[model samples]
Target: MKSLDLSLRQKRILHIMQHNDTYITSAALAAKLNVSSRTIRNDVVKINEELAPYNARILSLKSRGYGFESEDPKLIESLNQIETAFFSKENRARYLAFKLCFAEEPQNLYDLEDEMYISHTTLDHALRDIASQFSDHTPYIRLIRQKETVRFEDDEMKKRLVLVEMLRKSWNYHARRNAYYDDNFIEPKVLDFIIDLVSSNLNKYNILLEDPSIVFLNLMIAVMYYRIRDGHILPYEPPIPKADTSVYYACQDILNTLTDHLHCYIHPEELDRLYLFITANRLLDQTTLTRETAKDYFGPNTRLIAEHFLTMIQNYFRLDFSDDDDFYITLLQYIRTLQRRSDIYNEQYTSDFVKNDLRIELIIAHLFQPLALQYLGKTLTETQLIYLAYCLCGTLENFVHNHPGDKLNTVICCQMNMPFLFAMKRRLESDFGNYLNITALLPVNIKNSFDFTDTDLILTTVQKPITRNPATDTLYMSINMTEDDLARLEHLILQRTIRKIYTASPSPHDLFINAFRHEKTGHGDPYSIFRDMAADFINAGFVTSDFLNDIIRHEENSTYAICPGVAYIYSLIPAEKSAMSILTLDHRITWNTHKIRVFIMTCFTLEDMPITFRLANLFYDEAYDLPKIKMEENPDVLTRYYLSFIDEPLTP
Candidate 1:
């Protein structure tokens, strides 16, 4: 079949229909293509001719727009070969970025709209997405807009951004090639030639640079040429970077060589600024260069402040790595980079501390937060804290906690074959490290012959009545352990009571008297059920009338069911008003239109978020069944059941 040339819009419509078998409405296609339904109809006819060569036709429905169906396999394969503007969301982002970056003049709305073949609405959205996307990923250069006029015009930042991107691409072995690089007819041999010249000069000066470093210097030089050649020269007076004389000299030598190659009038301060960058980058390839070699040139104040932070961390964590020279050297380097980053970001130090947060980032932030204001003179971002924490973990991981290893004796009573049992055991050891010892693996044939009384824990495929000590609990697991199972097991290894069904606590029969009705509401209306529950709590003196406000607040947020058949809702209350409530629907009732078999509510302060979080996890366990626990008969049963799973936050 011969090829057919289709417009970008038509190809997109065809691509959408080709991938999806269901009929797509013309109105739907029109909205996506940013055109009227009539235009979509007109495009469909031309698309049909394009497909006719491949013996495929688009199925048009009366109310529905169109679908694609083809008997020939070669038809779809040949369609992929057709080069059209079938750009993905990411491709559009790159295209917009390229247009904005290289544009000498501010681009208007209509111009961008025509260039992209997009509706004004689509172009505006693309611009906004590009700005937001780059703010997170590419902080050096950003997309700017003023009253619908747009361009990317941070020049020095532009050079930095291009260099950063090139370095990133070199490291990202599996990263997708940029679509614009293929579409835009831009010259790169000039880029390559300038890079080669810079690389050659650095080698000639006996400066050992990494491949990415050479690429960066090469790209930066090209950026200077392209901008200057087009009459976009940076001011001769550039801010000098804080650096030693050696780095300043090396930076100048490289720039001098670049100027000679291009026959360009290079500014002197530009050389110093570039030198400052190399010094900040810290990509010195000399193997013999020790941390002290760099530290000897650092300011006295930076060293003193870093030493204070090291002392505080050491005292808090009960760590002693003061003897390690690498630790001191790396700490000094972080201090320097942090200052530069803080200056660039304009992050000011504050006395505020972080609350207990779950993510590793928040934890690290909370730990070093106090030191930031006193020493660094600025608040540290989570990103900065993250880098510090990772470095600390890496350096002190091996020798810090080498006192003695305590291994728990664990037994795996799997009915599977020996090969399968060993594989499962190895996987456990790999995940848990030296925390557990697989002392025994009993097969199904010898189940009765084995004694598990001395074991700490027994894991099996199914629940079995094994004679063991009361302390030695049995955990039933699936043949294939998932990530959730591993997490539960890890917690179980420490707590050993994570899956305890019922710990046998006081039953709450009096909290709800004859008012506890088994009535099921229509569609499980939340307002109706909550009204009745609030009455029961008020009448019983468990809570005051203001409890209704808390209930409404919880319901309005549309609390999601933590487990498959469980929904938990809670709000902060006065210490006196703080109480726990349980309501198990007689029949499955809908809360927020989602079926709820079990409802647990707790009115407590912020200190209890961990308790609520743990309760949700407990209910989500697979072995759990909602109907089995009769809340009316035993209200306090749920209370007793959860006592074993309460874990205080490590910090608190």
Candidate 2:
């Protein structure tokens, strides 16, 4: 059976009907589609041909609305396939590029130019063109003096963004190819020059480009260099120039020798960049010279590069690295890049300061060596070192009365994993000495400790627990355990909590009351103290029409308070603004809302809805439910009891 092409709207209509089997009213479909009933009818006719293969039917119901039914498995499969293909093109491109860049070789333009007839001027032009390509991303990438790199800059945010894009594009390019050399595209030398130019500039900028995409870009650069060195492969049609023997021979010799040296694949584009860099630096002659001589000039310079990175991390974040990689070489590379380009440097410092800092980082790592050994499982990475130091420093300040105390009382409840908790504990004591007692709880135990009321502070792993005690006034903290871990955790937490839940009704009554609970024990809303502030208004005769109007005006400009569920509706004339309250009914009111709920509402004037929305987000962080927690079986009573807490007497 031939499949018909369907528009997105058509597909949406089909999808809606497929799930809503039985007679569905035309009005209901119209509502879902945000169109008129007549429009829905028109859509039905348009989709009829596409649905014909499945013998599908769109029927109207007296009650429910409009729905569809079909028996054709083939049709469903075809629709699914169409959907997949329609959405996957962009993803595939991104994924391919990421893979290719990482798989390529790492080399300079001089080596690549040795394999080709390209003049220095041509190579320079190609490099410049590639750099120009990224000009649009200038908000994130910029050209700064080579001698004046800083660790911090006013535009740090933009720089990070550009670095991310560069790495992403490079990775995408590499993930798509294995060999760079083929007669179907530009010479590998050209491409390599472009890749290297971008990469070197990126490095020079001292941008911390730690992203998975970097690996891909690196790989793409490598493979492309190898290909171009091996042979000329142009992808464009015609206008292909035949290579001169002398030029081809030079390129071939350089390519062959380098390939053997590099061991992995090298793309032609990388070769181009190598040639440009070597030629620009007078390193091009080294290729023709003895192998050992080339080694001296082109060796990995791993330590020097590594030191450069260590210096950056220490200055920007005020953290030191112990030179640990632990399966994080790619991450390390990115950090080094960020350090080099970050505008944190001041003219006051000498070269010795940079070297001394590297030495200090090395020394710190050695100090952490014994402490890290305490953890039986898990390898350490450089990123973890900083976190460990912070934990130890905070602990010492809190627990230690004097310098160099003995036997730290660190209880790691560790809602976090053992490795993170252990590393943190180690770094703290090693750096600060035993001046403190630290207890870290994994989230599971942290929740239990809430029951005890004994823990001074709960070091939780999860962000924004569903319940927190307000009376105790516990301090909340946000800390980064590792570079990637912090970003991932923050993203996951915010994504779940910040996005509003669209509902058809108010939260169940039980949920409303439970939402106010500081813990299992009940209390008036902690924010109820604002009522005293309100009392001052009443006693001063300020709680009048004029006062209410003032609040309304204030709300017009900015938020009055943070109210989540129970909105306080106030207006000059309640009747005039009563309709404003209707906006609150997302769905018909449901009676079952419980403790794991969002609660608070403050409505002063009809116009304050916008203000309400702005403040609604303040508590938004607290509403995310723990997936592990189950609802109680006595849900109805729980709901009623929860609501009673709010409706029940607090003062009388």
Candidate 3:
């Protein structure tokens, strides 16, 4: 019989049908698979067609549902084979990788094809996928195929790295700990013994290991033991210069215990690699390490790297952390530890603390990638980037707290008694004291004569003032300020304050009016739009002739879609003059994964860092209605709408 070419889901449907003597409804199957009932019905039709040659079919009864009917024993044997073979492409690749890595000799193509119950073509495709995965995610390893055989060709250390990464990907935190006793890759007895031994030795040396690190360390030990026992020893390379820290002594003790108990002659080169691994994974007890004494624990270059990192943050994000000793110490410690194992990629994990602000954090992290590569000798993984972002977030919070920008100068007019008016002034001060500076508290009758020259906003209690300064915005509050009134007052204060920080003589409004361009129809892709925008920027003398290519190159490295249906693409290199070009499309164009309608391209000088940062924050704010702004057809209307986020009233 020919091999049945069934998908993993189709094969699963067959298995579920074969095990049941009675008919199984599509609803039940769908519930089991967590798919739609319609999908189950479609899968049944495809499965029946594949099983037809073997004189087997799944019968569908109107009310009774589907039943498996087969007389040929060959059909049952094929179903059993399907159960034993790998189910999905990912699993098949993983199986092939493990077989090749642990094999004593190169694996024959024919043998692998037979063992995997797949045709030669399928196995070849799987091999290509494995190679691609390694190339993209783990650059240190390679999958080599020579005619009719295949094997992994790379450094032994990198081979071990791949093995540990595969194991880590296969199991979660709790599952990994449980795998210590239940995994078949390593003997349960040996794995349990190694974990207990490492735990005891780490404790004996007064070293602390977190849960994830403990699991990772045990996996490393297990992989090293099996590989070394199989005659795969790491070659000796001269070690990098380093201080003899306490973690080094702890690693020595752990390895010495493993060597004596496992009865295997471990190589010294492996010991150095293991020490680096332990040092990278070790957590410092902050209570024991003070700022004055922490310098003693770090390498000489750590301080320089930390200072450079802070300087980059200050220069790009306009956040200064010069005097933040705690942030400085924290960054120094992270740099010292991360530099030790920078070559190892830990992209499989992410910090849960940064989910809400991941986009901004990713941009910040991308900005620092070059810095990390220059100092640490490797680009940071996503997980490490998130850790660095966490440090930046801490510094940003401190900077904002310490330096609240210029407060909004305001005047309040109320039509009540002096006592009640005084009470209202106290309320505004108590609520918005950080953002609002109340210049005067006067009666409603004197609103016309009040000095509005320096006022940023005018708040009236009874009615809207008729003769207020045209440039100064006004808000009407109720006599008894409701929750809605207070919320609106707070929002207005924030808008004015942000405007004060981001706007200058040539205001954002003016810039928008000057650079605004409208496209009634969009092109097939984002590149065309980028080209046109680059032409406009060059004509306006805002950027150089190579600005288009520069933006494209930056976009390839990092695509920024600040919000849904909007993309904010910019160049890191300083331009001739700071300028922005807005392009609004009537029809959406594909940008990365989003169908973007508004493209805001900016070319800013180093002096305009604050404006760049402010624009990013404004577009990313949840309260800013981007869809409404994009819907406006007229350029003047759209520009006003986009910049009028401050004018939008607060919703209850």
TM-score of every prediction relative to native: 0.51, 0.24, 0.66
Q: Which ten residues in a row have the lowest lDDT in candidate 3?
A: 174-183
Rank candidates by lDDT, best first.
3, 1, 2
Compose the digit string of candidate 2's lDDT tens values, residues 1-652: 3444555455556655654436667765654554567988887887776667667766655656676666873355345223112222332222222222232333244543443345555544543443443333234233331232212122322333333343333122222221111112234454455455545544543322323333433433444544445552323333323233333333344555546755645445434533332222221232243423434433354334445545544432233333333212433332333333321111111122221223222223323322233421222333334322322332222322333222232233445567777776675455433333454445454454445233323334444542344211122334455544433433332222212211212233322343322212222332332343233334444244444453444333222222223323222221112111111121222211212222232322322222222123222222222231223223233334334433331111
Q: Give the whole-model CA lDDT for all candidates, comma-separated.
A: 0.54, 0.36, 0.68
Candidate 3 residue-wise lDDT, 172-197, digit = tens? 34233331112357775787888888
Local error of candidate 2 at 238, Å?
28
Off by over 4 Å in 1: 1-93, 130-148, 151-188, 191-218, 238-253, 260-265, 283-335, 342-362, 365-433, 437-652
Alpha carbon deviation, residue 554, candidate 2 (Å): 26
For residues 1-652, write the lDDT of model 1, one tens digit per residue: 3334666567567666766658888966764554567989998899888777677878887856588887784455345333324255544655676667667778897887787788887787777777665654445466667787887766765534643453233121112211112322224566556656655655555565444455455556666666666666665574665546666666666677767776787777667656755565544444544655755556787788677866754543334556666767767766776665421221111101111112222232234545666766655654465456545643432322232233456788887888998998999888764456688888866767887666767778766765446656567778989755786776565343212211212111221222243333333565665666566556666567676775574344223332235555544332233345566665665443335655555543223223333343444442245455423334445545544333211110
Overall local distance difference test of candidate 1: 0.54
Location of the lowest summed lDDT over 10 successive residues in candidate 1: 346-355
Report the lDDT of model 1 for residue 552: 74
